[model samples]
Target: MTNTDVTQLDNPLWYALKGAQQAYAIGSSHIRRYRSGILPFAAYDYRSPGNIAELDSFLEKDEVFFLVGALPSLPSHWKLIRELPCAQMTLELPPAPLQTTTAVTALTAADRDTMFELIHRVQPGYYEPDTHQLGNYFGIWQDDKLVAIAGERMRLEGMVEISAVCTDPAYTGRGYAQQLIVHICRTNLEKGNMLFLHVLTSNERAIRLYEHLGFRQRRVISFWKLINAGTILGTKL
Candidate 1:
């Protein structure tokens, strides 16, 4: 496959807010985060105390947010929660034909609570309450319950990150998550957008699944999770 300016992938969140996902952006030109309750992601043109302070301006006391790539050293007002290093994989070629054995329906407004609960249950912290509004999400209903789901997040001009791919524990090993993933990858590729996903490097099972579906490991981005400490040293945090 030909490499076509995947440099933007190096700092996907920042470029995303600067490009296609600008409407969801907040903060100054150099440093920014997504609108509250959309996605708790922030990016900057460069890392510096000034940028950190600028980002601080966009958040409230006790707020939380994420920064991918290198985890910056916090200045008392911000506390390091966890450094989640992830394997960044990309799909240049189309995935295997979507297995249609199970019906994957487009999740609607009615399914928001169910979707939120399931995603947070399986993969908490990355997703926000209103994250479903960011992109088209699909699900598989079994036994009158939403068992599996996969959807988009952190969008750039011509790229989309596949996220929230999860399934109920009782529904594992039946390929429910796999089906939703294939459907999402295929659907996004058909729209001419480059596809990529971030799975924790420790999640060998999920990584293998994506690889089997034709996603190759492009790099590893260390996503730093941080929380606002309100104020410290008598300075507004």
Candidate 2:
């Protein structure tokens, strides 16, 4: 479990756009973003006019997108809707051996609807119907029902994000989330990628659980939700 360079940990979206998941990115030399329906993250090297222009070009008029890391200088046509303070946490893998849960299964397209239902019901907004296309997901089942899930998102050269972790309300106190997270962590660690994730700064309970699992907070980043001003009243950028 080694520490990542501060630059790499601080600007994860930029690195992901420029590294392992570059194939999924859409932007010019200065800015890049994942295609719509995959992930809403976009990033740039600096707050230059050219970089800002390039990022604007990737959005449809009025479409909303999210920017993580340093907030860049924005053109008037881009409006900042909200900014969330988020904690970027990282864990060096091969975590202390978790009690293996045999019922945890690798999820596939056939389980897509159930996955969406569980995620939307518990933790919605960030996940889309097709987000499963971005990476592998795993879940725990109870009587054939998807009760808990944890999966990958945001890939960079040597790191993979563990995201979309959730559990059904009926199953909260049973340690299902912890089991699924350990499963995903062990899997990615075996593949040689360190694990990282973002949680709202206000989510203390989740933070405690992550810390108990050996994850440490690397930095705090702003999750900026922006709306394309050009789309307002059908205006054009």
Q: Write the per-residue lDDT of candidate 1 for residues 1-237, one digit (tens) a residue.
A: 223468899888888888878888997777888999898888887545355667777877888888888655556778889889899999855777754689989997788899999999988987888898888899999999999999998788778888999899999999988888888877877777788999999999889888988999999889998888887434664
Instruction: List the candidates' TM-scores in order.
Output: 0.92, 0.90
Q: Rate the local accuracy (lDDT) of all candidates.
A: 0.84, 0.82
lDDT, candidate 1, equals 0.84
TM-score of 2: 0.90
Off by over 4 Å in 1: 1-4, 47-50, 232-237
Q: Write the per-residue lDDT of candidate 2 for residues 76-124, one digit (tens) a residue.
A: 7888999999889988435676666557889998988888899988987
- The Cα error of candidate 1 at residue 199, in Å, is 0.6
Residue 214, candidate 1: Cα error in Å is 0.3
